[model samples]
Target: MIERRLFEFHFANGDKNGVYHAVYAYRNPDGGFGHGMEPDTASPESQPLFSIMALETLDEVGYLTKEIILNDFMPYFQSVTTEKGGIPWMFRPKSDYPCEGHFKTVKEWAALSTTAPLLGILEKYEIDIPWMKKAEQFVWSEFERIKDKHVFCYLCVPRWLTFLKYTKNQDKAEETINNLKKWILVDGIVCKDKADEGWGLYGKPHSLNYATSPESILHSLFNKETITSDLKELVNKQKDDGRWDTWYGISEGTKLEWAGIQTLWALKVLNNYGEIEK
Candidate 1:
């Protein structure tokens, strides 16, 4: 339903409100999202990661208004934030619906992976609220701590890059980018080769995942030849059934759900690079 609405909005001249209504079904009373909006977790309880998915959807349709952020999302974020002003990847779900084993457990630490992306999304929309200030502090502090570190997770690379992209401090962001560049494709932060297992899977962040659009700051990290090759590979990844496949092993139901979302994402990325026909 969500993918259908998104397809309509993007390709079939459908009303953006349709997308909103479909996504709103996932919203909890707490203003955060759950109920399998993220597909990995069927838990009805609100989660920070699910909220990121919600915010991304809202932003895609230009429905992420300041009012919504303040009245809905901010309150939920405030409620779950850790002492370090960052949210956890997941909280223990109140109701036990089907969820991945990792998400089923409580994540006690404040995670930069989730928090940076949230901050980056807010920064992308240029929306300001008091809660963001604290999040910004936490994200920046983490960035500083990890700048010199050799081992950084692939999942966190794009999230941190997104934060750096829209951050107010261009000088520091650029420096951080330069510092991190040495480790990006070098230290397994990005899967440069297609032969790598789970190369484009959920956990493996790749060059295209980092750059996304041609206009992205991360685009500078890869040369035109590399980008072109990646784009061609991306185009060829489409299956005969008109969907992309996720290498991550999941249930059939979850796989179908992910296929829809992945198809939507592929179209968007292709459109961004002028690969889509009018």
Candidate 2:
């Protein structure tokens, strides 16, 4: 099944010989950062900016390589990361170079879930890079110092999952996730009164971005097999694509990246406990 899916993404759209397999839109070699898809795209920035979740999908699909996966992917990734002293949250393809700390905002859902997704991928890829240590330390240190802040909810959730996935520090992982649970109001819902809730590192997703997001931390908990039955409503929200939305917006629609992080989280939760919608 995985193999068939792999061919679909890696070769299905290409010629039978698979001559130009590196058609990833974000990597259009010219695709400016627009809609995560570029047509005749080119920019002076030359940075292949990608969401961490997006990279995970590619690697999980077994398509990442030195050629397609830029050696500078991490550098560009770090350019937006704090450890690299980045002020740019994202880059504009129109610019000559990626802006350090340039992003004006980290979207609500992304604010909560993006880092851990990157951390997981970085941990897996760091074996080859080693230079990513600085960014790792920077994020880890900040995570430890201000953990109690509601905004720290985003960091801790994915960080816990990253550790669970990459490190053998089961105790630490469990502890982090447990502590993060304090902010969740499971029996109720976040309201307009606390709408300014900074659940993510930055404020976001209106109500869904914070400690309250039933879907946000649910995956991390499921990965550890620590919380079962509490995630039915979350899991049932998965799309038919064997993945869940990265962030859903019915008005503008959603950008359901359908990445592996979601799939892994859903699978672990459902497999251990039972499918939700069944």
Candidate with best TM-score: 1
What residue runs in model 1 are displaced by over 4 Å at the alpha carbon? Answer: 121-128, 147-155, 195-197
Tens-digit lDDT track of model 2 for 96-209:
432223232323121224455555565565454554455455445545765756533442354345544664445766676676555443423223232232211133322333
Q: Rate the local accuracy (lDDT) of all candidates.
A: 0.78, 0.41
The per-residue C-alpha lDDT of model 1 at residue 237 equals 83
Residue range 1-278, candidate 1, lDDT tens digits:
88899888888888888988998899988788888877777878888878877777777888778777767787888888998989988887777687777765666678787898888877876887788888888888987776645333545676677788888888988888887776665756666677665666655666677678988767788888887887888888889999987854258889888888788888887888888889
Deviation from native of the Cα of residue 35 in model 2, angstroms:
3.8
TM for candidate 2 is 0.48
Clashing pairs in 1: none
Evaluated against the true structure, the overall lDDT of model 1 is 0.78
Off by over 4 Å in 2: 1-23, 28-34, 37-49, 65-72, 78-88, 91-116, 125-128, 148-156, 168-174, 185-278
